[model samples]
Target: MDQPGLATAATQLCGISHPVFQAGMAGIACPELAAAVSETGGLGHLGALRLPPAALARQIAETRALTDRPFGINLVHRGGPAMFEHLLAIAIKARPRAISLFYGDFARVIPRIRAAGIVAMVQVGSVAEARKAVADGADMLIAQGVEAGGHLRGQVGLMALVPAVVDVAGGRPVLAAGAITDPRVVRAALALGAAGVWCGTVFAAARESNAHPAYRQRLVEADTDMPRYRRGLSYGWPWGTPHRAIPGRGGLNPWRLMGGGLRRGDKSALAGRLSLYAGQGVGQIHDSLPAAEIVARLVAGLRTGSDSPPSPQGQEA
Candidate 1:
């Protein structure tokens, strides 16, 4: 067997040249980005959280049209009562290389996914979740830390969570996420027992992603101490759910003072006003290159050991 630190199960499962995975960012994930990453020899992903059935089918078809390589879809399990059923139907039709589930049980869905010959990858934030996911038949596990940009499940940081999940996974592949931007972090994740690293903020500024120009600019310019923002009016996704992003003046305290407005309910607010999701790794984002370029840069960095300096506090990029 290959060394635990080296790329092994991750490459085999996704059939990609590298173990790097483009973490599926909802609203930002697009077919162009997915296909571009896949073309660059990494696993790309499409977020299927908010899409309707027909829209999901169209997105899959569009992605297929862009690249012949394998790609994955990310499904948020707690979206609605019929989410799983809708996802299962879409998975069967799309026949993707892999389907990743977050914040849900995989027991009932894993068999159906396997029956369709699709790999079932589960994202978990704790050791217990990892063990349960493996026993429930997950092909791979994503260890997400609190420093991650989006909704997170645990307070553990990546340095500790990766190894814990790896130990609990019992030989199943584990992908470490949160604050992963540089190649050194990727190497560290591998050394810590993860088969790969899933990066969301690193690619949020990618050219192919659907993030707004202002949002992309913020990622390139934001600093590490940017106050992470969240609203109670939207979805009560647990208080103190740390989201690292470029904090605005007055921090996010003003948002709280405003009683956590329903700004997310308005689509137009997503471009710049609402909380722009990002990770501490945003400091490493220097350019808004294409997905292929981003993958190539990561692969190159891993090979050459290049590391970008951390950004100043309170800055965005």
Candidate 2:
């Protein structure tokens, strides 16, 4: 098959060849994985959630050393100027090709990102948020739908969220994030006016990903019941955020896994207990290939046809 023919405002502005933006998933989404994708022509992003300033800087340097291709970092805004300023300083110091913001006061952060000459992309789930992001000066808007994995705040479905965000974007590049793991999903997003597609599940299974061996195995064997969103549990930090993830160890019942969040103690002791997050499209993921190979297939699949991804070798949740 021929290469997928996609070139969006996002691709041009970010200097990437394709309109594929890898989601900055916390934990497993690291420098190696990000660099691998960037090398293959897709925008790579580091998920720098809760990383201390020093560690953040180190990871940025490492990723830079890996690839000269454009790459960005994601800082999940925790609703405070201090938080924004802290992460912004680290990112600016690293000087990435772009910076993606999520759930924070854009009015306070967008200016700084722009001032630094770095492209700014904001991920939003609602039209109101999209309007606010643009008004605050977002260079790109990523429309996230309800079926997405990770910590989701609202319930707007992907189909409904994309057009609304596009309408509010006023021509700025808009990438669709959420349950978009198949070629059909990618085609649908492009059809709905999205400038590109942001994917997590597919890349999370890449060989370069830092996911634990067990976690990697789960992704390959993932059926429908793979992801389990942490709803009302706040284990002190990003816990109570209702983030979606892979089921707990041994495929145990979700609620029985970490029901009340982290059990009191060393904190890190229960770290491995968290669910391995994948989108609602988990069953579509069935292999552990190199990041470059995965990107190639995705680009090819998207360019081929929207007739459901190559027969999935997975089962239902």
Q: What clash count goes with each model?
A: 9, 10
Cα lDDT listed for each candidate = 0.73, 0.76
For model 2, the superposed segments whose C-alpha errors exceed 4 Å read: 1-5, 79-83, 234-240, 249-273, 305-317
The worst-scoring run of ten residues by lDDT in candidate 2 lies at 257-266
Candidate 2: what lDDT? 0.76
For candidate 1, the per-residue lDDT at 148 reads 79
Each candidate structure's TM-score, on Cα atoms with residue i matched to residue i, is 0.85, 0.86
Against the true structure, candidate 1 reaches a TM-score of: 0.85
Residue pairs in candidate 2 whose N, alpha carbon or C atoms collide under 3 angstroms = 150-243, 150-244, 151-243, 224-316, 224-317, 225-317, 245-276, 245-277, 246-276, 246-277
> Mind giving the per-residue lDDT tens digits that candidate 1 earns over 1-317?
01122257888877878788998777678888888888878888997877777888888999999999999998877557686588668866788998888877778888888788888888888888888888888889999987777677677888899988988887888998987776666767777988888888877778888777667776777766763644332233344544444443345544322211112224544434445667777766777777776665556545544456333222333
Which candidate wins on TM-score? 2
For model 1, name the residue pairs that clash: 220-317, 221-316, 221-317, 222-315, 222-316, 222-317, 223-315, 223-316, 226-247
Model 2 reaches what TM-score against the true structure? 0.86
